[model samples]
Target: MSAPANAAVPQAEQSLRDTVLSRGYLRLLLLCVLLGVPIALACFFFVGLQHLLQHWVWESAPEALGYAGPPWWWPLPALVLAGLILAPIVTRVPGSGGHLPVNGLGGAPVGPKELPGTVLAALATLPLGVVLGPEAPLLAIGSGLALLAVRRSAAADAKARAVVATAGSTAAISTILGGPIAAAVLLIEGAGLGGARLVALLLPCLLASAAGALVFTGFGDWTGLETGALALGELPSAAGPDVGDFLWGLPVAALIAVLVTLGRELGRSTVGFTRRGSKAARTVACATAVGVCITAYALITGRSPAEAALSGQATLAELAADPHAWSVGALVALVACKGLAWAVSLGSLRGGPIFPAVLLGTATATAFSGLPGFGTAPALGLGIAAAASATTGLPLASAVLAALLLGGDAAEQMPLIVAASVVAFIVGQLVRRQRPEGATDTAGAAGAAR
Candidate 1:
C-alpha cells in the first residue's frame, strides 16, 4: 500500500508539471505574436512619422519652425505653458505620467493604462528641446498600449501579463535601433531572462521587429522618404588597430568613463536641486539655461544653434562622414557643451540620454581622430560604443548598435569596440563600487526629507 501511494504521488506531480509547461508554452507563443506585431508596427509608424515630419510637416510648416529656420523662441511661451500643464499631469497621473525614459533604459517596464500619457508627454516635451530622447517614452507607451489590448482580449495570468508587457516595450523602439535584434537582445539581457523563457521571449521580439521594419518601409514608400536599408550605404573598411592605437584607446576610454560618471552625478544633483524648487521655476530656468548655452556654442563655433540643441544625431553623422569639417578644438567644445546640455536636460526635463551620449562619444572620437594610429571612422565607431556601454552598462547592446551603425566594417571593428567597452565597463563598475554605502543612505534620507 505504501509503494502504491508513493507511485501515485509521483504520477500526480508529473501531471501537474505537464499541465504547467503546456500552458506556459502556449501563453508564451500567444504573447510573442500579439506583442511582436504591434511593436514592429509601432516602430514602423514612428520611423514613418519622423520621416514625414522631417520632409513634409516641419518642412512645410513655416520656415520659422522648420529645421532650417532660426530657433523658435516663440515656442518658449507655449513650452512654459506646457510645462505648467505637465506639472499637474505628472503630479496627478498614475506612474508619474508613465515610466520615465531613464527608468525604462535601466530595465523598468510599464503597463497598458499608462501608454497614452507617456506618449503625449514625450511628444510635447522632447520637441520643445527638453534635452531628452523619445526612446523611453516610446517603450512605456508601446508596452502600455499592448498590455491594454491584450488584457481586453485575453484572461490575465501573471506570466501572460509579463510576457505581453515585455513584448509591447520591445515593439516600441524596435526600429529606432538598426534592427529588431538589438532591441530584443537589450530587453532579454537587461531583464536577466534565461533558458527556454529567453527563447520564447525572443520569438515575439524578433517577429515584432521584422513587422516594424516592414511597416516603416511601407510608410517610407508612401511618404517618399528613404527607409528600410539597415546598412548605411557601403560598409566602410576598418583599419586594423596598431599597438599605439590600443594604448591610446585604453586611456581615452578611461578618461571618457570618468567624464560620463561626472555627467551622471551632475544630472542627479541637478534633478535633486530642481525637485526642491517650484516645478515651473525649475523648468523655465533649465530651459533658458540650455538655450543660452546652445546659442553660445553656435555663436562661438559658427554652427547652428539648433545643432547644439537637438539630439545631435545629424551632427554626429556628418562628423563621422567628414571628420575634418570640424577641428579638434571644435569637436571638444561640442562634447563639453553637449554633455553639459544633456546633464541639464536630465535635471528638469524628460528624454532619453542614449542619443546624446552617443553623440558626445562619437564627437570625442572624431576630435581625437588625427592622433597617430587613430583614423576618423574607426575612432568614431569605437568611442561611440565604448561611451554608450560605460554609461548604460549595456555592453552587448552598445557593441551591436555601433556595429550596425558602422555597416560592413562591423566585423573588423567589433574586436576593438569590445575591448574598449570592457575597459569602460570596468572603470564604471569600479567607480560605482567605490561609492560609500552611507552616501546612498544619506542621499535617500535627504530625498525623503524633501
Candidate 2:
C-alpha cells in the first residue's frame, strides 16, 4: 500500500509538470517577455516624469523663487493644489484614482479604462508632496497595459489574463524595488499561494521582470536618464551583529512594528472619515492635513520640508549615507510628522504605502542607535525589515527588500534582518486582530468606493 501511494504521488507530480510545460504555457511565457518591454518603458517614463515634477516643485521652484530652499509655507499651497487637482479625478474618474494605499497592493489589476485616472491622480498628488510612492501607480499602469493588449483575444481566459497581469505588474515595479526577485518575492509571499498554482504564477512573473529590468537599464543608459531606483548610497560601516545588537534590536523591531501598525490603524480611521461626507472635500482636506504635517516637520526641525514631503526615497538615501547628520529630535519629528502624513496619505491619496513605512522604521531605529548594544547598521537593517514587513504583511519580502537595500553589507546583516521582519510580521498580525470589527466594515466600504 505504501509503495502504491508513492507511485501515485509521482504520477501526480508528473501530471502537474506536464501541464506547466505544455505548449500553451510555453507560449504564454514567451508573451510575457514581449509584454515586459513596453511595460518597462512606460514605467520608466512615468517615474521619470514624476521625479522631474518633484524636483521642480521642491528644488527648481525654490531656486527660481529666490529662496535657498522651499520655505515652510511651500508645502501648504503645493499640497492644496495637489488636492484640488486630485479631487476631480478621485471623485469623478473610474477606479477612484487607483487603490487606496491603506488597502496594501493586492487589489485587482487596473484595466485600460482606469489607467488614466491612476496616472492623473498620481501626477497631481505625488509630485506635489502627497506622502506616497510610485509603486501603486506603476502596478496599475503595467496591469492595465497588459490587459489592454490582450483584451481582444478570445484565447486569453481569466486565468491567463491574471497571470499576464501579474507579470506585467512585477515588470513595472522591478527596477524601482531593486529587481524582479524582490518583486516576485512580494507577489509570492503576498499571494499566500502554494505548490503548482504558485509555480504557474511564478514563471511569467520572473521572465517579465527580467525583461523589464533589461529595458529599464538599457534605456536609462542610452538616454542618460535616471530610473529612480530605490537605493542607499552610503551606510555606516559595521561588522556582523553582536549578541548585544540582537538583544536591543529585537525589542526595537517590535516597537517599530507597533508604530507601523498604529499608522495603518490611523489610515483605517481616515478611510472612515473620507467616506462619511463629500469625498472630494474630505480628500482635499486630507491632502492639506498631510501638507500641514510636512510644514510642521520643517518648522519644528528647521529642516527642509522636502525631507518630510514626497516619497521618502531621497531622504532615506541621505539618512543612510549620513545618519549622524540628523539630531535625535529631528529624527523623532520626522517619524511623527512624516508618519502622520504617510498614514493620512495611505487612506486618502493614490500611491504605495511601503516606502514611507520603511523610512519611519529607519528613522525610529536610527534614533535609538545610541543604546548600549545597538549599532547604526544593525538598527537600520532591522528597522527597514520590520517596517516593511509590518506594512505589507509579508515577512519574507520585507527581509529580502532590506537585504537588497543594504547592498554589500547585506551578507552580514541578513540574519538580524530576517528575525526583525518575522517579529514585525507577527506583531502586525496581532495588531490587526485587535482592530475593532467596525474597521473592517469601514475598509470594505472604502474599497467599494474605489
Candidate 3:
C-alpha cells in the first residue's frame, strides 16, 4: 500500500472512535462536567455583575450625591437612558434582542453576532431597573457559549449541538431561581418534545443543572452574596389542603388568569404600535411609558420606585414574608403598577419575563389571602402557580417552580401547589381559546426566568 493510503486508515479509525464516544452516555456526562464548570462560572459573573450594577445605580450613586433615597423622578431618566442604550441594539443587531421573552424559551441556537447584543442589552436594561429578569438573556448567552466550545470538539453533529445547548441553558439558569429541577422542567416544556426524544434531551439537562447548582452554592459561599436561589425570610404556618382552599383556589386562578391575559393583550398591542416608529423611537416611547407606570406605583403606594421596577427578585422575598405589611389598597396599587410596567417591558425592553410574573402573582395572591379560609402560605402558592401558568403556558413547570420557592416546606405544600397550578392552567387555556384570532399570548420570561 502507498504511504498516503496507510495514513488515511488511522485517521478514519480515530474519527470513528470520536463519533461513538460522543454518542455514548459516558461522553455526554464528561462533557456535562466540563461544560458545566465554565457555564456555572459565567452565570456567577453575570449574576454578580447585575447585582453590582443595581447597587451602584440605586444605592451608591444616590448616596454619593448625599440623597437618602433616589428622588421619585429617578426612574424616568433612568428608563429613558434604557431606551437610548437598548433601542439601537434591538433594531440594528441580529437575534432581535435574543428571542423576545414573550415568545417562550429555546429557539434555534443564537449566533455569535447576536450573542453580544443579548449581553449588552441585558446589562443595560436590568441593572437600570427595567421590569425584567436575567433568565431569557442568560439562556441565550449560555447556549451561545456552549455552541462555541463544541464547534472546536469532535461532537459537532446536530444532536450533539442540541445537547450542548440544553446543558448550557441548564447550567446558566441553575441557581437563579430555586433548583435544578425547575430549570429541567422549563427546558423540557419549552422544547415541546416527548417520548424517547424528551428523555434523551433531559439527561444532559439533569447533569448540567446539578453541576451548575453546586458551583452556584460554592460561589455564593465564597462571595457571601447568598443569592444563588430565592428564599422566604419568614414563614406563615400553612394549613394542608382544606375543602375551602380547593374551592376558592379556582376563583383566584380565574381572576389572575384574566388579569394576566389582559396584560398579554396590552403587550401585543404595544408591540404593534411601536413597530410603526423607528426602533429607537419605539424603545423611547415604551420605556417612557414604563417610567410613568413605575412612578405611579411609587406615588400611589409610597413605596420606592425600585419596588415597581426591575425583575421583582428583591421585592418577592419581602412580600412573601409579610403579606400584611401593605394594606389591600397598597397591594392593589402594586399589582396594577407592576403589571403595567411588565407589559411595557415586553413591548420594548430586553430582559426575561418570569420574575415579574411571579411578583405579580405574589401580590395578587397575598391580597386574596385576606378573605375567609385562605392563609398566607396557601394564597402565595396558589397565586404563584396561577400566574406562572398563565404567563408561561406550562402547568407542570409553574407547579414545580411554585413548590420549590417554598424551600424546605416544598414537600408539605406540593399537593396544594399542584392543585392550584392545574386550576390556573385550565383557566388560562380556556381564556386563551376565547381570544381573538390574532390575539397575543401573555408577556414574560423563564418561569421566573424573566
> Quick one: best TM-score, which candidate?
2
Ranking by TM-score: 2, 3, 1
Go through the candidates in order and give each one's C-alpha lDDT.
Answer: 0.63, 0.85, 0.75
After superposition, the stretches of candidate 3 with alpha carbons farther than 4 Å from their true spots are 1-23, 195-237, 433-450
TM-score of 3: 0.82
* Tens digit of per-residue lDDT, candidate 2, span 1-450: 699998999899999999889999998999989999999999999999999999999999999989999999999999999888988888899988998889788677799999999998898789999999888888888889988989999999888888888888888979698999998887766655564365345434543553455456457657999867876664664576766877898889999999999999899889989999898999899999999999999999999999999989999999999999999999999999999999999888889888999999999999999989789999899999999988887777888899899988885676678778877877777776465554331211112112
After TM-score superposition, what is the CA distance of residue 335 in candidate 1 from its true location, in Å?
0.9
Local error of candidate 2 at residue 433 (angstroms): 4.6
Clash pairs for candidate 1: 36-208, 39-171, 40-212, 112-144, 132-351, 133-351, 133-352
The digit string of per-residue lDDT tens for model 1 on 1-450 reads 799998999899999888768976677767667667767777577645644543332234446454565443433443454466556556556665543333226433566555666666666555554555667666666666766776766476665666667667666767677768877766765664454365345435543553454456456556898755665464457654555566677678776777766676677667676678676577566666666666666666776555566566767778777778887777777878778877776656665677777787777766776888776666876788777776676666777778788887765565566666666656766664354554321100011011
Give the poorly placed runs of model 2, Cα more than 4 Å off: 195-237, 433-450
TM-score of each: 0.76, 0.87, 0.82
Candidate 3 local lDDT, 1-450, one digit each (tens): 999999999999999888767647567778877988888888789889988999898888888988887767789988889888888888888876776655555456665567888988888778887888898888877788878887777746777677877878887877685668888887777655564465355434543553455456456556887663665574653545455665676688778877776676677677777788586798888888898998888888777888888998888888988779889998899899989989878766777777898889889888888778777777788788888878887767887888788866654455566666666666666665465664434322222221
Candidate 2 weakest lDDT stretch, 10 residues: 441-450
lDDT at residue 284 of model 1 (Cα atoms): 61
